[model samples]
Target: MKERRHFIRIVYQAPAQLSQSGAQWSATLKDISLHGILLSCPDGWQPGDDPEFQVDIVLPETDVHLTMTAELVAYDPQSLRMKIVNIDIDSISHLRRLIELNIGDDALLHRELEHLADLAEDE
Candidate 1:
């Protein structure tokens, strides 16, 4: 089945948190869409659990900073990976633009293109 959600995957090293007073953890963003983002952090989160976090995403071309809140969505013990969900879309547009620019030629971009075409056709 085709992926219903479109995401731009990128790898970056940044500081993230699970709570206001929680410990800071290093994380790598896996993918991002208009509404949310997915990231991999150290093995410290559980499925269905929500943990607030902040992440700084560097724009690819401009090196601009985009910071936003993220919530823990899932965790894998075998890979020691945590999937984070970003909630702030407006605050991260620059980062998304950077990702789109970098990923314009990728297969994932084609998928997103197809999804957009479908949406347009539906409308």
Candidate 2:
């Protein structure tokens, strides 16, 4: 198998809510990266159903918040899985800090950001 992920994923079980086309579901955040998320949406999802989706990264305490809209890249029927597409960076600084906190390092995050920047330039 080939590795195809841009950012490193870290296990994070934060609570979240997903909504699309008048369909809303509470989901358990499984793992996350600066770009995307893998979550368990008990309400289930269908493949190729790219509805207008929003993910609110709800966490305990504090007033900080991070929410983004993403396309549904894939869904697993057997496990009620949901994968969020790469977030368009409207909050890159906050996202960077979140990734740094979870990964527990700044250098790695910086490298990932640089790589992402280079990729953007090439496109």
Candidate 3:
């Protein structure tokens, strides 16, 4: 199948947490992009009727933690895919820099930032 992703995915594993309905679970980060994230499914997590999640990823060897609210997009037995729906300015800045360093293309990163901004404007 042809690739359908618009954002470049960077593989950066980190410890993460997911929260929903006042409960929290530990999860392992698989990868991330400007638009979404892939994480190992939290133990005992069931989709059911809940689709929104609060996520926090703590970068390894750093004091940085990127937090965002994401909507469940898809999932399988091993992983959960989420689309970033909301993020604060500070978290987004940190995530942007993280992506920039991993992506290694200033122009491409800038274009993606513009697209992200446009998406926010449309919402």
Candidate 4:
């Protein structure tokens, strides 16, 4: 199989809530990258079910909250994974900084961001 992701993932044991309308569940973060997040929920979910995620990250210096809507990518009996298809500018900026700091690789982060910017400019 070919590697298809643009960002590196790392174990991020954060608390997040997934919700759609009246349906909701709290889950532990399994792994995260700049583009997607993998979580272990109590139950399975379906693809095409647009859901909103709110992840709370508290640090000693400051606290950050990310609220974004994502599209379901894969799901199993106990795990739910989604691609961050859409996010607000503020949240995306925060996420980018978070990943850069956690990954400890500013150079790599800059390259990726430049690539994304070039693609967007081409569009």
- Compare the candidates by TM-score and give the number of the best one: 3
Candidate rank order under TM-score: 3, 2, 4, 1
Per-candidate TM equals: 0.50, 0.78, 0.94, 0.77
| lDDT string, candidate 3, 8-108, tens digits | 99998999999999989899999999999999998898886889999999999999999999999999989999999998889989999999999899999
lDDT of 4 at 26: 71
Tens digit per residue, CA lDDT, model 1, 4-52: 4445555544333333345555555555654455556456644443356
Ranking by lDDT: 3, 4, 2, 1
TM-score of 3: 0.94
Q: List the residue pairs that clash in candidate 1.
A: none
The Cα error of candidate 3 at residue 81, in Å, is 0.2
Candidate 4 least-lDDT 10 residues = 53-62
Best by lDDT: 3
What is the per-residue lDDT of model 2 for residues 16-121, given as tens digits with 9 covering 90 to 100? 7777777777777787776677778556555434544788776557455568776666567423333444454545556677788888877898898888778768
- Model 4, residue 113: displacement in angstroms? 1.5
Candidates' C-alpha lDDT: 0.53, 0.68, 0.93, 0.70
lDDT of 4: 0.70
lDDT of 1 at 51: 57
Q: Clash number for every model?
A: 0, 0, 0, 0
